[model samples]
Target: MSRTSHITRTTGETGVDVQVGLDGSERTVEVATGVGFFDHMLHQLGKHGGFDLRINVKGDLHIDSHHTMEDTAIALGQAFAEALGDRRGVVRFADASVPLDEVLARSVVDLSGRPYMVHDEPVELAPMIGTDYPTSMTRHILESFAYHARICLHVSVLRAANPGQKPDAHHVVEAQFKSLARALKYATRIEGEDIPSTKGVL
Candidate 1:
């Protein structure tokens, strides 16, 4: 089966476009969101998810990165949901745990056609990764994506820093995205011939 979707979302605050192939061999991906750190995280998602994903977004950056980040996630989430369609023959539920230096993150996902999310980040971040990407926007972005995609998602930072180690926002956040990517890859995989839920629809 072919699973792919292209979506465009234009609003007064932002304009976003996304293309996704859930089961592509090449995994060709391109993303340009004008936010450096956000772009890096999206790259991690695409690279680790083992899918073909593309995203382009333009927003009122003069105000802040909030609009751009949220809108990008919204469009990307819509693309994924569209690609999955009826959620046929997919794993539908998966989890992943990943560690990066001083940070460890775990993600669990269920594609139940319901939107719900729980995010827990115990580590204290530096507030901003750089001049553009705000660490506070991390939860907002993930929440927006899960809400739009109609998925049940739970993310937690199991580890952050030690006595001597310092909290690095990049590592902390990147670990979350990477773990989420793996979970999504597994959950979106075609593993069976029928829908995963008893309700007969997802």
Candidate 2:
């Protein structure tokens, strides 16, 4: 059985197209969102998670990166849910800790049908990553993903900055994305024939 999904989402703010393959190591990843650093982060998912991912988004960059990130998460999350189908025979729960220079981030996920998220990065950041990518919208993007994907997600920054030094916004956010990709890879892997939940459904 192949696990794959494709989605195209359009709103007044943005148009997003996403393709995903859960077990497609041989597949390629292509991402374009116009936000340079965000594109770099999404590439981390494709490269680190060892999955096929393609995302193309056209959003109102003149306003901000919000709409692009928002709709991309929406389309990607919906594609993930579609690919998983019944969510049976999967790991269902997984956690990953990743370190990037000055940042250490952790991501825990449960493939439950219910959607919830706990994001615990409480440090002050430098406002914007680039021209359009806002530093504050990181949580919003992940929140949208968890809701649309219908998964329980918890992400935190365990250690960042050094003594009195300020944290690097780029490293902080990149670590989270990398950890999230790794956790999702583990959680979505096929493991058995039955659902992992006690309720017999996920």
Candidate 3:
């Protein structure tokens, strides 16, 4: 089965193009979004998910990173959903726990053709990772992706070993991305020829 999709989204505020190959083995990824930290996080997704992904985005960054980040998530989610293509023979459900230094994140995923997301991060982070990327946008990114992809997703920062200090923004976000990537990799695995749903569709 060829699970691949290319998507283009354009608006007054942003222009985004994405390509995804769910069954790809090369783990090839190329991303240019103008936001340095965001690009790094996206690379983690493709690398750990074992997917071939390419994303190019141009947005009105003169205003802020909001439009670019949100639009990218939407475009990526749409491409992922299109690549799934009836969800036949997919594992359909998975979970993963990932730790990065002082932070531990857990992600649970179900590709059930229903959109829902619950994201919880207890530790506080700095307002911005750098000059442009807002720390708050991390959860929003996952929520937007899950909504557009029609997937059930639950993510949480389950532990922080900071000893009464706030967690590092980079570690917190990286752990979430890694956990989500692992979960997605497992959920997209081909286990059999039949759909992994009871109602015969996903």
- Candidate with maximal lDDT: 3
Q: On residues 85-199, what C-alpha lDDT tens digit does candidate 3 reach at each position? A: 9999999999999999889999999999999999998646778988899989998999999998999999999886578787788888889999999999999999999988779
Q: Candidate 2 has what TM-score?
A: 0.97
Which stretches of model 3 miss by more than 4 angstroms? none
| Candidate 3 lDDT trough over 10 residues, lowest sum | 159-168
Reference-based TM-score of each model:
0.97, 0.97, 0.97
For 1-202, candidate 1 gives per-residue lDDT tens digits of 7899999999999999999998867778798999999999999999999989888998999999999999999998899899999998999999999999988999999999999999999546898999999888999999999998999999999998877877888899999999999999999999888988888988
Q: 7 in model 1: Cα distance from truth in Å?
A: 0.5
Ranking by lDDT: 3, 1, 2
> Global lDDT for candidate 1?
0.92
Q: Residues 1-202, candidate 2, lDDT per residue (tens digit)? A: 7889999998999999999998976668899999999899889988888789999999998988888998998888899999999998999999999999978999999999799999988558888887877888899989999998999999999988888999899889999999999999999999889989889998
Runs off by more than 4 Å, candidate 2 = none
Cα RMSD, model 1: 1.0
